[model samples]
Target: MSWQQIQPFLVALAIGLLLGLERERSHTAGKLPAGSRSFALLSLLGAVAASVGQWTVVAGLVAVGALAAIAYLRTSEDDSGTTTEIAVLVAYLLGALAYTRPAAAAALAVVVAALLVSKTRIHRFAREIVSDIELADAIKFFVVALVILPLLPDRGLGPYGVLNPAKVWLLVVLLTGIGWIGYIGVRALGPERGLLVTGLAGGFVSATATTASMGRLSRTVASPRAPLAGALVANLATFMQLLIVIGLIDGDVLRRLWPPVVLGAILLVGTAAFVYRRAIRGPREDLTTEERPDIEPTTASRPFALRPALLLAAVLIVALLVGRWGTDVLGPNGAVLAAFAAGLADAHAGAIGAATLASQGGITVNTALTAIAAALGSNLLVKCVLAFTAGGRRFGLGFLAGMALPAVAFTLAMVMTMTMR
Candidate 1:
């Protein structure tokens, strides 16, 4: 029992004494159960025993285990439940006696003790909110973002110059990411704010889909003013989508087109606002108590499905090949027609093909612009038809009017610009 050998024991005891003192004060205030002196003595005895049992670490562990069991029995008799005091006693012994890996063991003990102490507050928070399904959905979204997107290949393949696995998957990732974010926002905000926010967010995900959903909701929901506001918001999302797509493909092109698109959207929003205001002000009898349409949260059927990615890639390759083949066979007219056909199912590939060709100097800017417009125009027509068919007459008509008017105005402006140039 040299003085130098005893120093480590005393140091361990001091550390235990400090922790026990804090616990004792907490107990005095009814926040804990054990006192400082008892803990300090236990720590000192454990450290000395550990120093003496240096040849057999198991002996020190046995001593600590016996002390912990006695403490647990005493605390159990007093409270009939609760593990805090017993845990503190065990921690004190381990901190004092666990010298082989003292620092790591002590750090872990502190963390475990803190967590045990926080159990009451943690239980209260767990009981307050957060359903099982919401938690599951959050985990599901994380799996999609972290697990799925990175696994796919990024190259082009097949007959038409069609398949780029990475690009197609990228589109899926973008749409899924946007939809998941909107779903979370809606869940947090509730339906009243959800409708407006969802419409704007959904537009970023898919404006055509948003427009269709809004139209259907309007038909069923009797609140003319709310639906009208929602519809206007959804349509505004369409212009935003246009800007987004343009920016994704070519920031320079989007920058160039910004002024006209912004001006048109502002005018459309003003008109829609005016119409809604006038309609609401006219008569109380016209307003009815229709149930709010149950707008389901958009879930990815399976965003990273291999088949869909392959199909998209196939379409793109075919579109590129057909676009090039057509341009050679029938010139600009052939390419525009090819773009229109491709646009019916998917507009992105056609637009990308045209843009690529233009960049290569194989196609003139005017021709590329015309093909892009035709592809978009064709896609818009398909959406309008689907909206009408799926949503019924009134929905169909309103959507048609809403979508067609701006589309025609934009097309005319583009046409005039092309002619002037």
Candidate 2:
């Protein structure tokens, strides 16, 4: 056969060989049904059948399925899984697919190999790392996002002309999803990975919440540095969530707001890194016997909370209406006040409100940008208060040091917006 005609067979052979190698390696003692040679021959058979005619391909697939069934029946009752049998059929299909879509077939082959290789890790993760509560939460999350979300109406409806059930629920899902991921990261990876992972994940769920948790930990722990480090990382998630909210609601506002938000975020991250280093590594503070027990850092609980996410969605609607009213009665400046108020509860809500206003032409992009900044400023202030009250003087002071530079950056960005306009 010409080289062109033989190309599909070659591709199929390679795909089978790659998957077979992984499957073979996975078997430590009991031999698997298919090895490299067996898989390669199956692939070649499939390719030859497909090259002949449609009927030939169907007949070939049926023959392979029959063989797989026979193989399954022959295996001892103790060997319950159908993985090898399934693999054989998939390999055949992939071989046929290689004739038409070589690139796609190759990618599928790689994915299949990876899955086979990850069997041990996946089993270990399910058995040891994930808890029953976590599994149930995962199912709940999927049901909300995949099942309930699709059933909700996408268009705005209901009282006050300010509610879109689908949009609101989607946001709730988004927030919950982000928080859930963070929770998983903290749970599976543990605190050994430190603040970088914990902080970011917690921040995604709720930066302010993370800040409060960290601050409270700092008050009790002898070395407040680790908790403080995590609090700093959480700010990163806060900024990211803000950007995400803006982008989803109004891309134009997002573009306008990104400059200041990004700048402030960078400054906050830098400050956090500096504080974390000093807190964790700096010279020893002589802790008395009584104080020593208080100094050890404690673990922060999982971050995601569904009820709070629903409350945030409620707050977003309130902010939108309040912002619209402010624009209608008091003009653009009033919208800034509304944003500040909304931001005290959740900055993302205020941001979404401002972006909605901009999208409707009630305010300019500059006004929306300013409103978002005001909201962020208000949120930061709240976090600061939480730090002082919950963490006491020492923890609060340390947090202040980390937050100052970012606060300045945000102020400058807001001022710049006014000047540029």
Candidate 3:
């Protein structure tokens, strides 16, 4: 027989052996009906029977099920589960599948074995790690991302053709997903690691929101140092995300943008590290303690807020309109202004629009870079304002130190690159 014809039977046997090994390993804990040899034989039976006819495979499956039932009855344990029996039936089917689709059969077997092995970790995560509210929020996030997002129209709509429902919903998903990561990190790691973890993670989702949240926290805490450190670090996400956004819009733009952006992020991180050291070493009495009056951490209550995500969407929509209008009215100059304005709301929107324009040959690469840089500057300024308004002077000043040096470094990098070109 050819390799193809003989390969299926061999695969079927392998699948059975793999599953049987897992079942046998698990058998130490309980009275499992099937073990390595029994499962291997069951798979071999399915492959041989299916090779004869489809009906033979079905009959074999039924027979295995009947034998499993008899085994369960003989054991007569009230608490006995049917997992092994179900697995036996699945293994038999996989053996049959191996004849026609050996690759699929092997893949499914691996997946099943993986699921079996991961049982403990899965249970531990579900039972102990994830909170009930987090689970509910995850369900909601899925609904929005999968159910609602797919249903939205993909094309741009509205008077100026600025609104694309799919894209808008996509932003919602992206923002919420980013925020959720930070929320989970902060929740899982606890405040012991404090602002550094929270800020870095939260920055990915919404640096502005992180700034506001951290700022608010700063006002309530005795020291304001931790929140100040976190707020500064959160701005790093802004530049990091800029790289991602521009790369999505135009690779050329990203290629040109990365040098300055990366330099800025490194400077910001260095500044944040300094502030963090100072904050951690600052007077204990000046910091939040169990006895101190502190604002309840937002990460504990919700993974990501629906209201903020929707508001962000609203801001992006406005930026889109203004950006399109700017391009139409003032040509390239208007585009830069639009980017600056949009950057104040969200740097990503401005960068994306500018990059799109550059990609379309409507603007020069230099012009596109300028627009993106303008947006970044505006966004940073907004963060600074938020630090002052929400976190007060101490937090604002601390954040200023973190942000200013980076801004200077980035500006110098941009100038050096431009001059070199």
Candidate 4:
């Protein structure tokens, strides 16, 4: 027999064993009526019937459901949940799915087994850990990102082919999503570690938004020090990402760029370390305390700041239009200007553009380096302005101290490189 002929049955049997193992464990706990043997048979039964015809799978379902119903009726009152019966039905369907897509079926079976194992944690989190408002915000973010995002047109709209609704909405989603990420991190690791972790992760997504989210969060916390550290840590991702982009697109540009980028990154690390040290010494609300305060503690206290994200997106939309219109007709020199325009809001945007153009031989390496510097400089200024605007003086001052000195070093390095020629 061909491999294709035997693959589905073999895969179905494996999936059955995996699902059955979880059920068998539950059965030992007296919470489930089905065991490893029953689940394995059900999966094999599905595979055998589905092999016969599509309609045979339906017949298999009826027979399985009938058996599951009988099992349910016999289950004790204390353990009277449809979980086992539902699993039985799902195991059979997974077997049927394996007839065509064995890989997808196997992957889903693992997820199902994991869910079974995580019952206690999931119950506790849903019942106790997550607040009504936090859950609601999570649902809203999902609806926007998953449901609404895909529905918008992908092409650029409005003036200068700059306003792509989907892309713009994605930025808005990103802003809100960064906040959620930080919130979850804080919940998992406590305030100081959480913000630091999420800031590093969020920077890869959108450093500016991460900075804004952290800055805005600084207002709620007793000390801005931790959030300030998070905001500064996010810049580390900016440098690393630029290096990756430049290296991939143009090696010469990467060589030209790495010095200032490295210098700036080293400075950022020292600044973040200093801020984090201060955060540890400062007064902070115990985020994971058992005693519930009237208000939530530290970072979780505020709802994901949606209004600011929307306003930032609005500002970015204008930047995109102005950037596009100003540089669209400029050619090579125009690309550099475009990079500056893009960099005003996004550190990587213009730098990537310039590097890509130089790689294509549209401009020289030195020109690409210049454009990149312009972009980075413009973006640094934006981050500074946003730090004050979103986070207040303490946050802003922390941001400036972390960012400004490194920026000066970067410019001096660039200028020194020039005069040497």
Candidate 5:
């Protein structure tokens, strides 16, 4: 037989085997449904039926359902779990899918098998780990991203074609998604894993928030080592996020910025590591992940930052408008000024504004690059102030020391990238 002709059957067989293995392992105590051989045969029957005709496929499914129903009825009512029954139906469908779309069928079969395999973990996560509020938040996220995003007019609206509902809300969704992931990470790991994990995750969502939280922790905690270290680490996200902005807003900007941004991140990581080591002076502090201070960076049960996300969305939209208007009115410096102002509130907005403007020919690429740097510098300025005011002098000094080398490295890299251009 030709490879094309044989491929679907092979895929169907593989699907049956995968699901059967999981079900067989899970059926430790039940007078259960079909096992490996039975599932395999069922899948083969489905493939054969599909190959024959539509009527054959329908008849096969009906017959299989009847047999499955009979098997369920014969088993005691006390042992009435429908997972296997549902899986049986899915297996039949996957087999049919395999006939026309073998690759898709194989992928879906793996997903089905994984679901069956992770039954316990999924149950635990839904019931024990997830709270009602988090579940609601997840639904809200889905509605916002899936439902509303599609409905929003993609074309620019409002002043100077700056306000595009879909695009602006997309920015909000991206920010919230990042925060939600960080939320899950911190909650799953808990406060036991030291502030390093917390810092990095939180920073990815909002470096300013992370820096402020770490700063507050520094003042209250016995040893400010973890807090100080965490604050320094949070800035790593700022540098990394530059790349995310450039990549998303403009490819040309990404091509120019990636090297410097990547090297800067590495430099920051190395610098943060040095500080983390120095700060962990005793066992009570952040000496180890398992045995560390009782400081918790993750707040209780919040899935994502709603207000800040909205605020950042506003800032980003304004930045875009400002970049356009400022350039039109006052030239390149206007874009730079707008970027710096926006960066003080949120650097992502600034970088995005600059790259977006450059892509649109509203400003020269060189101006965009300068604006991005200004944004970063201004954002750093705000962070420095936050560290000093919120974390106290020692934490502020420590954070600065940790950042100094990395900042120098980042500046040099940025200069080289520009000069090479």
Candidate 6:
């Protein structure tokens, strides 16, 4: 081979050497089987052999494979088999010789080595926490966030005038991350504290869903106070959801609304705390032994399906179109109606649609605020209905009261502000 061609091979050999040396040091420290010098020699030899030609590369692979097989055969007969070390050694030689595809081979080598080193920890983690569903969901989430979101077009379309796939998916990511954190917290609390923590966390995850769950729990259990406290906590999640929306759509709006949102959150939290304390103090008998529902990080059963996302995008387009049409026909009231109608299934979509309209000068801040408020109102109403339908009369009444009071207060506050302004 020419000297020019040999340069790339030399570089590949150097990388292999460095990695093998690290592995060798680990082996010496009781974490591996071979030393740095042995690995380095193997790597250098592999690179030289590969550089020679196809026949030389084949010969090198066969030699390494034979050595690995012998090592494994010898060790397997012993109680302390070291076949893994042998396999790693073979891999190291192969990686070094992979000059034509050095990057891919090196990456594979690193991953294999990492997997081997993390064997104990990985086993422990599997035993302690990971479930099949969680694993599947994690993989699905990865596909959505990494694979799909990036490929979508980041531009607007249709009449009412705003669509950005990147931004929308980004919002989805933000919500999923927040929901996942809350789900973890709830799961960690377990069934004993599940009701309270789940309710609070659920609010962050999905307040409406939490309310429905708690309402059902209340009906069979007869713990009015538990449902009451849970309901309050769930509403607190609504406030949080609004804050999240503001943060996602427009930070400036959040900054302006901070005072009211903070005040509202503090009141709701304090009320929930007081109710929780009272309920706990009253009776241990009231608490039942139902297993805590495993709250998913994301509400969607299927993790961010493209079909659903596309459907939502379509809905946003319709909302924008209707909102624009409403503004022209019924004025600001039409836009508010449009937002409320859209918010029925997705507050995030509604908020985004309204914000986009406002930004484009097609709607005023008051109009946007009204639309947001209406959407939230509709969303809360849906949850109330879900609680009643899914949970029963006892659960429904308690949940409705819990949700309604705060919602009413919020509505009044918004109305007064708009009027005063």
Global lDDT of model 3: 0.78
Compute the lDDT for candidate 6.
0.65
Query: Can you tell me which runs of candidate 2 are displaced by over 4 Å?
Result: 1-11, 41-61, 75-79, 99-101, 158-162, 283-304, 417-421
How much RMSD separates candidate 3 from the native structure? 4.4
Which model is ahead, 1 or 6, in terms of TM-score?
6
Candidate 4 structure lDDT: 0.74
Cα deviation of 31, candidate 2, in Å: 1.9
The model with the greatest TM-score is 5
Candidate 6 segments exceeding 4 Å error: 1-126, 285-314, 419-421
RMSD to the hidden true structure, all candidates: 11.2, 3.8, 4.4, 6.0, 2.4, 8.4
lDDT of each: 0.59, 0.78, 0.78, 0.74, 0.80, 0.65
Candidate 5 lDDT, tens digit per residue, 8-123?
A: 88888888878887888898875777888888878877887889988998998999999888888876474678888888878887888899899999999988888998899889
RMSD of 1: 11.2
Q: Supply the global lDDT for candidate 1.
A: 0.59
Tens digits of lDDT, candidate 1, 1-421? 7966666566556656666765654443333445566666666666666666764445755765676566667666455544555555565566555444466556655665566556666665456434566556557656655687687676645544444556555654554465456545544554544355556665554555666666665555444444444455665755655565556655544544565567667766765666466556755322322223344533222222445445545666666778777888899887788889888876665665665555545567677778877877887787777667656777666656665566777677666655654
- Higher-ranked by lDDT: 3 or 6: 3
**Count of residue pairs whose backbone atoms collide, per candidate:** 6, 4, 0, 0, 0, 1
Candidate 4 stretches with Cα past 4 Å from truth are 192-195, 198-228, 237-306, 328-376, 382-421
Q: Which scores higher on TM-score, 2 or 3?
A: 2
Clash pairs, candidate 6, are: 27-32
Q: Model 6 misses residue 138 by how many Å?
A: 1.5
Residue 285 error, candidate 1, Å: 12
Best by lDDT: 5
lDDT tens per residue, model 3, 1-421: 9998899899999999999999888767646688888888888888898899999998888898899889888655843777778888989999999988899999999999998878787777678778888888888888888899999999869746667778767766876776677677666665556567777777876788788888888766667777777777888888876776567657887887899999998888888887767776876633333344355434234776677677677766766666667777887788789889888888877777677667756677887888888888899899889888988887888788778888999988987775666
Specify the poorest-scoring 10-residue window by lDDT in model 5.
292-301
TM-score of 1: 0.56
